[model samples]
Structure formats: C-alpha cells, structure tokens
Target: MKAKNFLTTGLVLLATFSSVVKAQVAATDPLINQVSHLLIETNKQGLVKAKYASAETRLADLIKAGRSDEARKQMSDLISKIASDLATGQVKADDLKNRSIVTAKKLQKAQLEAVNQYVNGTLSAQDLVNTLKPLNSHYTALVSVLQRYQDVLRSGQSTAAPAQLATIKAGVTDKSSILYARFRLDLLGYSNDTTKDTLTDDLTQAITDFQKNEKLTADGVLGSGSWKVLNQDFAGQISQLRISIDRSRWLPDNLGATHVFVNLARQQLQLYVNSELSMDFKTINGKLERKTPILFDSMTHFILNPTWTVPQNILLEDKVPMFTTNPQKVLDLRMKVIDDLTDKEVDPFSVDWSKVTENNIPYTLVQKPGKGNALGFIKFPLTNPYSIYLHDTDSRNLFAKNDRMLSSGCVRLEKPFEFAEKVTQSMNMMNWSADTLKDATENLSPEAETSTRVKLVKSIPVYLFYLTADVNEKGQVILSNDNYGIDATTYDIISQK
Candidate 1:
C-alpha cells in the first residue's frame, strides 16, 4: 500500500526541538556524561539505534573540539530522534515485540533518572529540559502499558479461526476450540469452570462480561465481533499498541488538574479531578461515516435545555427531504424554520414545497429543547473547528448497546446532568451544586422557550482521543473495536517496511 505523509507534521514538530538545548556547558561536565551514557544505553538496546550513530559521532567530535554549543545542538538533535523513534516504535531489533519492551523500559528508566538528577541539582535545568522535552506523559504511559501488553504476547495461546468458530455446534464442538476460548477467557481474568469442556453457565457469564468490557453486545454468546478481537495475532496486537501510543504522543503531557477525557475507541468518557479518576460513563460518539474528530479543547460552559440548530449538511441530507415530503413533520418535531434575513419564524406550509430544494432552502431549522429534542436537556459546548460537544440524548436506550457510534458528529452522554454537576463543582462554578442541577433538570419542560446557560468562571480541559488498546485494573490487555479503522490505516502508514 502507498504510504501517506501523515507523519510529516509530527516530524516537523520534532525537528523544532533542535534548538531546545542551548546550554554551553563544557564537554567534560557530568551532565554531558549522563547524556552520553543515556545514548550508549539506548543504542545497546537497539532502540532506534542506527539513525543516532551519525549524530552521536558528530556530538563527540564537537565535544573533543571544545565546541560546547555545537555539541549541545547535536545532543538535542539526537535526543529528539530517540523520542521520535520511541513514539513511532521504529525499533531496530530482529525480535521487535520482545525487544521493544526492553528498549521502552530502559528509556523510561533513563528518563526518570534524568528527572531525579535534575531535582537533586546534579544536572542543570537546561540539560534536564532538553532531555525531557520529547518524553511526554504519553510516552511514559505508553511504556508502562506496553510492558503489560507483553503478558498477552507471552501467553502463547492461539485463538480459534473465524471459520472454525462459525461451525461450532451447541455441545458437539471439538475440545480444541473450546480450550482456546477458555484459555483466552482465563487469560483476560473472566474465567469460570475451566474444568468443563463446554461453555457452561458460568463460562457464558464470563463471556458476557468480556463482551461488555470490550464494548460489544453482552449476549453471552461469542459472535463475529468477539472473535475478531479475540483472534488478533501478537503482531497485530502490537501494531494496535504502537498506533495508540503514537496517537497519544500528540497530546499534551499535562492534560490538566481537572479535565474530561473521551476515548472514542472504547465509547467511554472519564472525568478526572486533581489528576484522580473522579467518574466515568458510557458515551455515544459519531457514526463511522461521520467520525467524531480527535481533538482537545476547553469546555467553556454548558446549556440547560439547549436548542439544536441543524447543520447545513444535516439540513440538506435529512431535514430538507423530510420537510419537502411532509411539511407537518417540521412542527411535529418542534422545529422552527426561520427566514435567513428576517430572523423570524417562517411557516413551513407557506414555502413553495416543490421549488425548495436543499440548495434553495433559505431558512434554518432549529429544534426546540425538551422531550424528543436531538440535543436533549444539556449541551457542553467546546471550542473546536469540528463544532463537536458533549450533550444529552432522550434516546437513552442507545446507551445500553455495546456500539454507540450513532450520532452525526457530537458526543451523546448517558448522564449529562450528573456530568454537568461534576464539571461545575470541579471548576468552582458559583451558585451551583449537584442538587441544584438535578432540580433544574427535573423542572425543565418541553415548552421552555429559552435554555439556562451557565458559563464557568474558568474553562476545563477536555480531550477527545482514540486509543484502541488499554490495560484493565488487573493489568490485562483490553482491546476495543477499531470502528473507524484508524488503527489499521495509521499502523500501515507508520509501520511501512
């Protein structure tokens, strides 16, 4: 497959680190020695080793020539290269999976030592800054998670093929498939009645739980989606890890003391307060065709009983045709058509129905908030080019499904009022409490003409990310469905051989 230049921007940003180390300390300084040791250790582990040799040689030459500035630049460039390679998993080892784990851990340890040395005043601030400029929080988290992933790889268990699983009878399947299923379930810590050859009631419950954890239908039966994730080979799983790691590296090291994180891959939202996991809940993201963009922004405020203005695309594709077919459908849904220039509600029946094509529709459709409203009862507005936000949905049944990618683009929260209360308290919004928000929600009515807007005194950071692989509390690898196929596409681009 042809490779896309998606890494071009990242590489350019990495190159900007060339000037980060401006320290003119002598070549014989202990800080220089520390950097040299780090380089040697990194090379020994074959962590993107080949590309750094020339830079290291140049740095050595500069040091020997008493050119401290040049040496610092060379060192910074080399460190940047190492960081870039770590982020991309461009390992040079013959056995990538096992070798990458070693390299990642070594680099992680070296980074920590540098940080500690700086705190102890053994290393200069300049050197420490340059050393850590590239290794962000994502890099540290990725290294830790990658180490845990090794357990899955080391299990050495093979899953049944899709074709084989498809042919399994109720109680007559071969033991090999059953054993594979049991071993996988056991590995994931959802094991039950392993002594039985068939999928007993306990084992079925385990499967149901596993399916729910993986964000799939909890039918207690192994379906195609379950097999697809279970049957991923070691290399494929590693690719997913690498892809998620690289994607995470794009985010800021400090996400903030209190922030909201939406992992679209898992269809989950987490609220962190003072860097602690405060709460988490199920969220419905955009559909595959209309994917919710991966981005970060400050959630400035939330609207109670918010109105929904149909976007141009949605207007043209869905509403125009519906209104054209049956004009009464507009009032039936409590949507008002306002004239573009007059700023006044236009009667849908007054418009020339036959002439009003999607392109010729000169009015905007705004859905009033309340029962059956698209935006539901609340909307957490975020500043992003995609115009995406966290919102409520009256169709609460959608949350019960494993796959909740059912929106146009914005995120639909299962518990919007609860989320708003937490955000308000976390941000120290004045004159509001959990019970206050609850009362407002309960009192809100379909006939409410205007929404109650509450702007926070300070905005809270929010990140919409897509990470396909994560570790559970037990440190077992939990992989989610790559509904957007981003993992496969990005892995192909970055892992090009």
Candidate 2:
C-alpha cells in the first residue's frame, strides 16, 4: 500500500519535470514572435559578473531596442527591487487580499514554465517580460528570499565571517573578540545584560548556558568547538537559501490548509493548522547509512502501547547479535520469538542459535510495550514504503544533544504524547486528546499491553523535505547543517535546471 502511494507521487513529480521542460517560453506566442532573437551582447568585458549583471545587460538591450523598453524595464526593476520588503515577505497581510484567483491560476501554470527559462537558454526581451510577470505574482515570497541575499552580494559586503581567533578563555583582555562572542551568545538565546566587553560574571553565565544548550562542555571558554557554531553568517546562509527557493518552486503555492511539514535536513517538524503554524518540535531523523527517504504521505492512524516488530536487517544485525552476546539480556528485555508463517509464539531457548543467519531467519522478533520498549508508550504511524513512523523514544536524554540525526529511518518526537493528542484532535481521530491518550496507555495490567491502532476521521498530509535554510519567527535567516550530504548536489541540480 505504501509502495503504491510512493510510486504515484514519484510519477507526479516526474510529470511536473516533464511539463516544466516543455512549457512555452512565452505567455503569448505572438508576443515572442514580435521580439524574436533580441540578444544582449553584455558589452562590458573583464568585469566580474555581478548579482543582477544578466538582468542589467538585458535591460540595456531593451533600452536600445526602444520598442520593448517599457516591457523589459518592468521585469528588470522587479528583480532589482525584491529586497525592498524583506521581513514582511513579498506577500500581503492577508492571503486573499493580494491574490487574484483567476490570475493566480494562470500564474501557477506559468511559474512551472519559468523554471525552464534558467535551464533551457535565453528568452527574447518581450517574452522574458511576459514570462516573468506571472511568476513574480505567484512566487513573490520565494523569490524575495533569493533576492534578499542577492542584494547583499551586490552591495559588496559579505556576511560570511572573515576570520576565527585562537582559544580565548573567559578572562581574555581582547575586547573585540569578546564583544563578537557576546553577540553570538545573544543570538543563541543566552543573553547577558552587560555593557562591558571584559567578560563579566553575567556573560560567563550566558556562555555556559549557551554551551549547555548546544550540548557542548559547560566550561564557558571560547574554543574551536564553540567557534564553529558561532560562524554562521548571512553570506554562507544565502547559498542554502537559494537551494531552498529552487526546491520550493516544485511544491504547491500553498502546501495545504493543514499539514505536517518536516525538513529532514534541519531535523525539525512543524504542524500547520488553518494554513498557519500551530506547533513545532525537535525531531530525530534517520542516520546516514540508513537514510529517511523523502515522502509525501498521510498519517492514517496511531498505536497505543505499540509493540515493535524488528525488521529483518535489525533482527540479524542488532537483536540476534545482542542476544547471542548475552543470552540473559533476552529474558530481561521480554523479547518474544514467534513463527514466521503462523501467529504462534515460540520458545526462545528452543531455537538453535547456530543455524540463524541473514539468509535463513525463519522467525519474527518483537519487543513488548513498557519500560525499555524501543517505542515509548505511543506511536504515530504513517503510510510509507520504508515502514517509517513517528513515535516516542525511551532514550529521552538524546533530545538535549545538538546533533539529533540518530534514528533508523523513522522520526522520534520530543513530546510524542503531546503530538499524538494534537494530531488526534486535529484529525478527529476517535474524538481524542492528550488526556484520553494518557488514560489509554497508563494501564499497567496485561490486558492493555498489546498494540491497538485507532483510525483517523480523515487522513492528514505529511511532507518530508530537505530545506536547509528558512526564516525564523522574527523573519531572520537561519541555517542548518547538511546532515544528508545533499545541499551541494541539490544546488547543482537546481542551477543546471
């Protein structure tokens, strides 16, 4: 069932790419026919290609052409003026106020074609104006992010940190470095209310707090580990922002009225309600070797007191080896070995250990729900090919650590019970809430130990993406590490296309 859904989504994406490739370069073919082969020579040589250099060259050609000057100028000015409104987004205060439903539908169709303008080749001056006008309307918010950084680059000032100093402890006499460190700490939510750059006691406390929150040593010393994190300047962030904007072109102008949006690159999950952000959570995604694939699926149900059916790879590589190393640990864990063909429990001791291998494992291994169960109390199951689901973890300590890419092809929620409640209420799943889920899983008796899947009133969409940079609540750019090693590759893909 998951496989079918995945295949369908893959087909849709491939179809989108096909349409993007074949889309007409002109809104009206006659407009392009009127301005055919209007090429810009880019007369200036030996000069570094600036941010809007291409647009500027095209503008000059249009001014020379005289006939298409007004049309081309509009396109050039729009690209140049995106930085005017950075914080409020290029969107109006209300979604409906700025949108022309009839125009928006046409713009959506044209925006899909505009991506090919960068990929296929040059466009005549008039056709470029027509193609860009609709795209500017539909993709203004996304385009603004790209243009914001472009404006920064055009101004000849780089936001990337220029240098890093040697290990400077708390009592350092260098005021310059200390002031910079204080700024970094303040940005990280560890504020110190001091005007002195002498590293006061209050500043030291802030440094220690920042270190603790980042899962670093609480020594309050400025060292190599801390410097790496402090150096995320805007110049560096723009590259990923460009990549994110390109990827956003393929997505819907609006994701959904309500949806679960997960950025695997950032290792964060967001829940949107009524097209507005309602809650966000820290998430642990799949590890490097076992990647969490990008999926556009829906959450159909959740399980209470969930039992884990160990997959074949884990059964051979993890469970079998661990149990073989210490047989007594198996009994302590309350693991059950069952026959593969029949729904019958088998005695663990009776199985011949010497015969078990990757090629010939004829039994299923399952862990019962309770303390030390891999899934802590509750699980939110989604339909996907990888059998991936969102659930609580028994190892809650990992949540404090900064690097949270530690799961095996599934997501671990920071507050699973709370998430379960929000999702159930939102989806009308059994008219449930946090308290109801708490009552269902709190029972300690054997009668309530088994897995119970509750159906949803309506399935909720979940989108797993790879956005590496995005705006914050205050509308400032934030960057994330490239956990999946796709930032560069994705950048290249978008640039080529």
- Top-scoring candidate (TM-score): 1
Q: Which stretches of candidate 2 lie above 4 Å from their native place?
A: 1-143, 158-235, 427-431, 491-497
- TM-score for each model: 0.67, 0.64
Cα lDDT tens digits, model 1, 122-237, are: 76645654564435444455546544444444465443343476422356466656666666676555657656777577767777778778767778777667766665664555
**Which pairs of residues collide in model 1?**
none
Cα lDDT of all candidates, in order?
0.65, 0.57
Residue lDDT tens for model 2, 1-497: 00112211222333332233224424422323222222111100000112233444454345445536464544435332321112112221122221111111223345335423522344444454344332211133434554544444456643444265545574578766677676555544456653566868877777676665445788988788877765555434444554455344334445777788877876778887776777887888888877676666788778888888888887777778777667666668878888888969887777775567988998988888866788878888887656778888888889877778898878888877777777766765655677777777754566667777888778788877665655544333445677776655443332321
Q: Output the TM-score of candidate 1.
A: 0.67
Q: What is residue 462's positional error in candidate 1, in angstroms? A: 0.6
Error of model 2, residue 365, in angstroms? 1.5
Error of 1 at 43 (Å): 10
**Which regions in candidate 1 have their CA more than 4 angstroms from the true location?**
1-80, 85-139, 148-211, 216-231, 353-361, 428-435, 445-449, 472-476
